[model samples]
Target: MDPNEPIESADSTPESTTNKPQVPPIPTDGTPKKKYVRAVGPNLKKLLYVVFALLALLGANSGYLASIIAMQWYTGETFENFFYFCMFLGHVALGLLLIVPFIVFGVIHMRNAAGRRNRRAVNVGYALFAVSVAVLISGLLLVRAGGFDLKAPTVRSTVYWIHVACPLVAGWLYWLHRLAGPRIKWKVGISYGTVVGATIVGMV
Candidate 1:
């Protein structure tokens, strides 16, 4: 090659020099990523089941109360005296009424707890119901053994007043129990309803 010849003669050939076409680099840093959505958990399902169970129980209990009132009306019984005796029997029977709803709810929801650990709410509620039943039975037996007539003229008799007052207290406590709830109002309301229902049965 001539000395003055353009240097392009040596490197101007594209294929002989190994020069490569430029390509943009893929982005790896500072890219906005998509968020993954999580699924709902089981505890929430259990809570929902419990709430539903409570609502069902409440309806059942309200019906039971209405029935007692209706029966009294039908019989033309003295509300102040004979009604108390009838309430005594009715409340004891109420205990028996509660078992079905609770069992149905447990099976429907697949709740396996048995009044243990945090399930104390259910356990305590059930226990109170049982106690109420027992109290009703015993009180009735006491009245029967004493040979005291429920239809006696006086409404303020000692035994009569105690029956009314004791039941009234129990009913109020059960209502408070039903109303007690934390962040989950429905859960608490339903769970607590059983207590009130059982108490009503005991008192009635």
Candidate 2:
């Protein structure tokens, strides 16, 4: 060591120089350690997975339905009757496949909301979900009224409008809820990346 250099003490550390509290060690004489034994609250991971899955399904349905609508609007349904029929069938099939899971997730969401400290977000989410469900039920009745027919003007005009609007509004509310909730870690981003990659590969 250079003579001009100040001698460093073994007791001193760079970390020790900072202003920090020295937490007192709790007594260990058979005392109840409530802090250590306390429950870590509800695990929200499954809820998040269910939510994102629903969002993905909603997005895919929106894409397919919007494309079909665009084809009809721009091309005047000049596409073959079989093509339109197939598209309608596909949309219904997707909806049917997703509805059960959607309802399940909604129930899970309500349960989670009950325990949520932030009731505002929970209430908003639930309200949006209810609106979405109402729109879906109305749309289903419209379908049944028309004998599973999309050719009817009422089904195309009125039911279609509600079907489009409700999901969009509900999705926006869900996005807001996500933003207001507790922040997730890098794992979520990684999982999303993997899912997207898998979806693209599957599509191709």
In model 1, what lDDT does residue 17 have? 48
lDDT tens readout by residue for model 2, 1-204: 789998879877776656688789979897875442111124445654655675665465456556556777887855436645665666566666666766776776676466656778778878877986976675675565444766778656777678778877876786676666667465876776677656534442
**What TM-score would candidate 2 get against the native?**
0.57
Provide the lDDT at 36 for model 2: 29
Give the TM-scores of the predictions, in the order they appear.
Answer: 0.27, 0.57
Lowest lDDT sum, 10 consecutive residues, model 2, at: 34-43
Candidate 1 C-alpha error for residue 178, in Å: 3.3
Q: Which number leads on lDDT?
A: 2
In model 2, which runs have C-alpha deviations exceeding 4 angstroms?
Answer: 1-58, 75-77, 80-83, 145-156, 182-204
Q: Candidate 2's error at 34, in angstroms? A: 13
Mark the regions of model 1 whose C-alpha exceeds 4 Å error after superposition: 1-116, 142-162, 176-204
